[model samples]
Target: MTDSSKWFESLRVSYEQGELNESDITHNPFEQFNLWLQDAINNDVPEPNAMVLSTVNKQGQPSARNVLLKSADENGFIFFSNKTSDKATDLKHNPHCSLLFSWLPQHRQVIVKGKAEEISMQDSNSYFQTRPYGSRISAWVSDQSKVIKNREELEVKVKEFMDKYPENVPMPSHWGGYLVKPESIEFWQGRPSRLHDRIRFTKKANNWTIERISP
Candidate 1:
């Protein structure tokens, strides 16, 4: 084997940071998530609300990308993106998706499985208004997931939009938010000796069932 291959195999971690127990967590997965999220923030985990959103297209091809979590509550997790983007197109065909929040510094991860649905236009506009002026202007410039000629073309379009909407930029019709209604949420905490703790909460009817699963 090559020296680089040997080096890769030699790298390992013991994961002695923490342990997760069933009795220690709240019955509500959302509450548990909040607690862990706060811990992540307290520990200075970068972009604590960022999550990996996984979606599958109609043809069974899978795609995963990082999206910032805008809000979370009993309703579910909310995020925003271009409505015409590849992820949005995938959601239109198949709403079923998964979200992963990895706090590597804390040796913890949260996995969420759910279905995504578009939020109201009013909500989208509310969030859009809060964004910075440049971001709002750029939103109107690029047609997400579409091919463009070059960087110059993109910069020219941005300039055009900036001049067009000099002061107050309106929210584009093609931009919106999505709510992922979670069906199952699993909290994973790494432990020593390659063993980990996993606590899962599954939704059934109007209540949630909690259980411990093998790591």
Candidate 2:
């Protein structure tokens, strides 16, 4: 085997940050998520709200990308992007998706499986208005997930949009937000000797059922 392969196989971490007990976790998965999120923030974890979003296309091909979490509430987790992008196209065919938040500094991770739904235009615009002017313009300029001749072409498009909307750049109709209504959420805490703790909550109707699964 190659040296890199050997190094990869040898790399290991003995997780001893903390232990997760059933009694310590909140019955409500959302509540537990908030508690852990706050803990991550307190621990100075970088980009605590960042998550890996996984989606599947029509052909059953899966794709995963990192996105920043904009908001989280009883309703669901919210994120925004171009509705015409590749991820958005995947969501159109398959609304089902998974979100993973890895707080490695604390040796904890959260996984959420859910259905994606578009948020209201008002909500999208509200968030859009808060973004920097350049970002707002770029959102309209770049046709996300499309091929371009070169960087010059993209920069030219940006300049055109910037010139067109010198002030008060409007949110494009194709750019919006999506909310993931979680059907199942899991909390994982790492332990020594690879004996991790995993607690999952599954939603049914309006209630949730909690269970502990093997590590």
Candidate 3:
């Protein structure tokens, strides 16, 4: 095998940054998530809102991509994207999904297994209006996941949209937000000697039950 392959097989990192205890976590997973998220932000973790979203298609093939967490509440975690995108298509075929937030710098991670559903048009419009003008234009430029001939094609579309909506770029019909209503959320903290900490909260019948999970 090549040296690069050997290095990849031998790479290892010790988990000794932190620990999680039952007393340190809130019973409400949302509250606990907020605490960890804020800590990540305060510690200068890059793009702290970025999360890995995993979705499975009708054929049972799973895919994962990084998306920004735009909002979170008692209801669910929200993110926006083109409805026609591959991920969106997978969601339409199968709403069940997973989200993972990795704060390696803080030796923390959060995983959410959930169902996804689109937000209301009004809410999508509200968020779209807050986006940068260039972002709005870019959203209109590409039909995400669709094959294009060249970069010039996207550039042309961007230019066209930029000229069409010079002032306020309206939210495209194909663009909107989805809320991931978590059925279970797990928090993980790295501990010494690979004895990690895991706490999980599961929702059932409008109530949440917290549990300690073996790491």
Candidate that scores best on TM-score: 1
Could you give candidate 1's per-residue lDDT for residues 1-215 as a string of tens digits?
56897787788888999889877889989999999999999999999999999999999999999999999999999999999999999999999999999999999999999999999999999999999999998889879999998999999999899889999999999999999999999999999987899999999997999999987
Encode model 2's per-residue lDDT on 1-215: one tens digit a residue. 57897797788888999988999988989889999999999999999999999999999999999989999889999999999999999999999999999999999999999999999999999999999999999899889999989999989998999899999998999999999999999999999998999999999888999999899
TM-score of each: 0.97, 0.96, 0.96
Candidate 3 — which residues are off by over 4 angstroms? 1-11
Please state the error at residue 37 of candidate 3 in Å: 0.4
lDDT of 1: 0.95
How many Å off is the CA of 89 in candidate 3?
Answer: 0.7
Residues 110-129, model 3: lDDT tens digits: 99999999999999999999
For each candidate, the alpha-carbon lDDT, in order, equals 0.95, 0.95, 0.94
Where's the lowest-lDDT run of ten residues in candidate 2?
1-10
